[model samples]
Target: MLRGAWLGLLLTLMATPAVATSMNAFRERAVTDPHGLIDAVRQQLDQAGIELPPARERELLWGMGTAAINSNDDAALAEATLRLDGLATVANDPVAAAAAGFLRARHDIANGVGDGLGEALKAADKVLGESDPEIVAWARFQLCDAYALDEKPAKALPLCRQAVTAYRALNDDYGIGDAENDVGIALATMDRVDDAAATYERSRQYFARAKAEQLVVMVGDNLAQMYLKQGRAREALALSRASLKQELATGRISDALNSSADIARAEAALGRHREAYEQMRKVVAQARTAGINGQLVDMLKVESRLAEQAGDLRQALADEREAARLGSAVDTPALRAIEVELEQRYAAREKELRISELEHANELKDLQLKAAEADAARRREQQQRQRLVNTTIALLAAALLLIVGLLALLLRAQRRHAAELQAQTLRDPLTGMANRRAFQQRATELLGSPREANAAPHVLLLIDIDHFKCINDSIGHLQGDRVLRLLTDYLRTAVYDCCFVARIGGEEFAVLCPQAGLAAGMRLAETLRAGVAALVLPQDLPVARLTISIGVAQFDGTRCHDLSSWMRAADLALYSAKSGGRDRVEASKLAG
Candidate 1:
């Protein structure tokens, strides 16, 4: 067997160089090392004025987002998904937009973001209405996935049926197989076990015929899980081992660990306490390495059963305690019941397994024969598997070589563009300070905090460069901009640490202060006035060593919440300051 495997590997190595790779190869490599591939593709897309298809891009983006989550980055997957969704507005292609929406929904489901489902469902509906049958099937699959995540299995099941029907219409065997697996999962959730088993069998058959090893493994695992639910631990174990063989061949370590747990269940059912205990320990070790707490608890329960069967009461108690510690409050009823039944079986199945094993040997042999045929089919597909591996490695090599230059150029351009965009969004182009929109947003967020209500209430100070347009008429608008920038610099320099400052429309400036009352706000405003008066400019233009009239209001006792009211009150105080003569601070008391 080992010599044959080596010969097969040699043949695969020799055949790999002859295969043709597509853009999708690069896309998958981009997932593992995205900076290079994503940036290169982005540059190409920008130059061609073409966009990456929305669905694929969204999937890639979500993958990146998930990686960030896995790495414990401060920003969540929902935050990244939101940014990707915003990009869809300019994406240009309807199919791409639909795909993006689908990805957003998936990411949301993973991150427990409920808001993504409605838009994903709508996008799927839109795509299905306009696209080819295969595309429609895929879209409907995405929709079903969304519904399943949203806990709307009724909606999910019928849509999964629609996906399978669509795929069948397209004569797409792989699509049908995938849809069948989904259908089985949905049916099982809805208490239709017999139908689920039929669906899973059909799925496995179709996946096998299509040479879809991944789907075969997935569906096999699903069927094994279903068997576990039905209290057929022996069957579940057999199926799980078959799935593990495939997962192991494909290098899916975590999936293999899951299958090992299922095999442990079967060992326990067969009264092989020693083997079950060993398998359960391996499952826990693998799960710990993978950082998957979810399956660790189940593995512990199995260990508890093994210990109980061996009359190791202390070991059984320790295992039970560990299982309880790792278990979640949200475990499914089926899962909980399985644990109970396994415990009961451990107590009751001591004598019956020997007789049952003898009677079931022929059936097990037939199942093994079927599995051997499936394994032979896998061996026959070795050529295509080699092609996939070669394509993946070559794409990675090409991407690594191209990425540095592409990222450098793209990042340089993006930073320049971002500066311009930021100015437009948050600054007065002439005055170079935060604009009205920025002022209002920061003020609301800063003052709305309940913690700030007890700390000194935030102060809002509004300042107008008095008679600024008259200065603009005397000096050019260019000089007017200089005057504004100079005054902005002075105010920002004077109280930059304590204040959030913005240029609010033409010649108007605002400051937000946390931990500041009306008196403190007035003092800060007067300091701003003094700094502006002491300023100098090189223009030799007739602009003021510009002085500002200040109006200040502390946030206290106002039913009319939000920044607009704060601005209005501050404006009124500014007018009062100007009426009293410019270049001084006027403070307004909060209204009762």
Candidate 2:
């Protein structure tokens, strides 16, 4: 028997390279030509009397199964897994057997076959003591995925994290990305929103760096779903749209369907319920045609909600019923019986496992439980710290608001005080008329305006009280002030409403009429002179009458270009008026 075994081993070793080469070729072709590769693999499996090395055969079968899974060729995966199982049993190779079991478990989970979770647990047990680190990592990943699919996130998280550590240790970027994605899924399922978003980002970066476009899309889909749940519907919509585009470009119809469903959910959340219902209806049809029952049921349920929101109550009810029917159909008796049979087989094999192996597994479970407890305690502590921080922030915000309100009040008070000061600067103290500075500003603004064709020229008038020094010499200066005030009151009532009057100097006043020509200015100046002469002094005053002289100048654009030149012309006219006679009006020759 030993000699026969040695002879068989020698023959198998001789044929190993050719079989390995063929398997590598098949794997390479699987992406672009999956159906052809599947046919070739099937033919190779069926070929009789073509004995290959047991190890090489196991390697080929495992590669083929993995390729089929990646290509989504379920039929080919099932056949390859079945063949690998039979070969592993016949060859009595523990590592090969464990690898085969892991592949079968992964296949079942991917296809939503009978008792995927149970099969995964059995496969994990089979590979528990396996010396091969790669197979052990993969088994952990598969089991993690199974738990995630079953909605047991609490059970799934630790396993997924473990798989991440294993993949990191193996320096496998693709595996690390895949494991991290599962970790994100588990975290999202547990409602740890921030952690899940961070994990998904990490996974997406890893996949991007590894150039795994499909895996990146997978991570994006999960992240989009999380965003939607967080009420960030616009972000989810953008991500889902991008993912859908990539999935369609890559010919990943199933993934594209998922992305479309996510988009519909996001649209619904964004209050586009009618649009969401239309999109979800199409996704449901595609899912049904693709035979993706689990996703179809989810899509149908989403469609029902969207329909209800869209005011299509009848369609909503129909979709709800279909979803229920499909959900019930997913857990048939035949699938359950298959699951029971797998569990029984796993149980029978469990009894033959070594005591030390069982102890190691038990210890691992205990460590996991302890880790979970520690994590919970840490989370509670973090929550306390967060509450404290939030309280501090709230207090700080309130204080900031108080400071801002006080500052605003101070600013308003300063502005009001400044406005009073500005008014004081622009008014004469005694007369309450525009001062010299205010007169100059107003005249400059009037002169700066465009001169329209055939428009009336602006006029400036300067008036001076006559014999003001004699009045002060005869009476007291206080009485002279009273006389000056009496003249100011006469001027106020004498000027036209169009005139801008200002006390440009002591005992002197100027008026700027923006709509008046030289003739109007002379007329206004004469009126002021006559009005002051006609003013009656109070009974207490010694002076019997008050009088004034006036100067008039017109500011046509060609004659006076600016306020300075215009004032000079008006001052010259005032000098002529003063030289000619008191209580008289004079017009400048420079006037337009």
Candidate 3:
């Protein structure tokens, strides 16, 4: 029964009008009416009666695949790519095979397949040396996108430029738009913000002119994000809202959800926290229903921050914990390993390509050398020998120089990696502040030096979040982590640059204020306490008002001889404050 059904379908396709239509007809319609072309090809693939040559059939399928990709029809694209691959195999056409592979790889990448980038890169590399200018341009554009996905913007930028130049030469406005968008992304990643914005604007204009509404919306979203990063919340909000409306009208539910999230972020940035929180709630619910865990996690994080801003601490804590759980589930070691493997494969393929080019150059050199030897044969043997000797010396010198340059680059990369690791070690991962070791080391350095006669005494403030353990127990460790991070933000803003703030223990932070007196320390501690106490949650929540207890101690050489002794005095005062009442400050009285 299955065999009969398959035979019937094959007969139906063979009898279609597409088989009778010329490839030029499809190609002409591809630019102005890609959707119509895709629909026509799809219908043709469903009917029967005509007999076309294998090459013609392959061309039809290729046209359909390209049209489907342009129209963003995944089902049609998949069908066309599958058929084109089979036909290309039967006809032994490498170019057609490469084209089919690239389409399939791009589709897979869009759907989040692990090896898609590697496959795309491989396919694009295959067609890059093709004689067809359009094919070469398309291959370069695909390469740029692949590199951008791999987070190598510097590598992607030049490829994007090349693609854009090729498209301009072909007068392919749609292709130019696509390449320009990629160029913008590469520029943005490299932190060339102004250049990126201008490129995106150009892309949008090209897309608009090409009547690619979907791509225009995509560019709008990119521009919105850039505006948000630049603190232009009003403009970001406007653009995101417009994009969201367009996405919804076009029935792009996933894109609409992303746009909504952007809108919420813009709202939050503009101080419309309640509106942002409510908006994100809807986005999170929709993302969860769609089972997009990666997007859901991101949306949940935005929602959590919005909740926090709106004084809904309970909701904020719940959202944070949920986001963390989802993130952990989505971010698996196996997934990371696959990503790394893809990157390694890409690097290996690039190395292979480079090696092939070098080998080809050497082959050409060998041919030239043979010609030279032939010419030298007509001359003196001694002159030939001297020429060969000079050539050998120059080649050896070039090889040595290349090797030295590579070694220098490797050494520099290793040094940069080591420096990053060192910085991470001295920083608290959760709070992004100095750790206990760093804090103690810095304090010791300050105390060991002799004080100037007119220099103000250094003061230390030891602060602990009130009922932080209870917060962890009630909300979970994930929320506790969020609280710590939020508190760190507050502390950073509250203290001056002259003060060194560090998270020394769980729920405990120390501030070492240089050139501060006992009175100044007490005043700063009171300000911190009041600031924390002002962090009130929603009235209906079970959580109490947030608060912190502080202990202030001024450096006294007569009473506290060393850094350890001075810290002990602060600890004593901290204990006194905790004993007196939480959310209060106490100063140490050192004996003169």
- Candidate that scores best on TM-score: 2
Tell me the whole-model lDDT of each prediction, alpha carbons only.
0.61, 0.69, 0.70
Candidate 1, residue 73: CA error in Å?
Answer: 14
Top candidate, metric lDDT: 3
| Predicted candidate 3 versus true structure: per-residue lDDT over 1-592, tens digit per residue | 0001101011111112433532223433443355677777667666632555665666567677655644456777788878777766777766667667666654444333445556666666555456666556656776777656444688888788877776665556666777787777788788787887888889889878867665676668777877887889899889888877765654444556778998989988988888989998999898777554545666788888899999999999999999788656534677657656755775676677667865786577557555654544444344445665876655655555565556556656865787789788789988789999899989999888777666668899999988899999998888778778878888998886568999999999999987677887889899988987886554544566788899888887868778888888998989889999888899986622
TM-score of 1: 0.39
Number of backbone-clashing residue pairs for each candidate, in the order shown: 1, 0, 5
Model 1: worst 10 consecutive residues (lDDT sum): 1-10
Which scores better on TM-score, 1 or 3? 3
Query: Compared with the true structure, what per-residue lDDT tens digits does model 1 show for residues 324-435?
Result: 7654333446644653554355335434544666458646755755565555455445534677587665655455435544655665586579768977897766766788
lDDT for position 293 in model 1: 51
> Ranking by lDDT, best first?
3, 2, 1
Segments in model 1 whose C-alpha atoms lie over 4 Å from true places: 1-87, 92-132, 146-155, 190-192, 226-236, 293-592
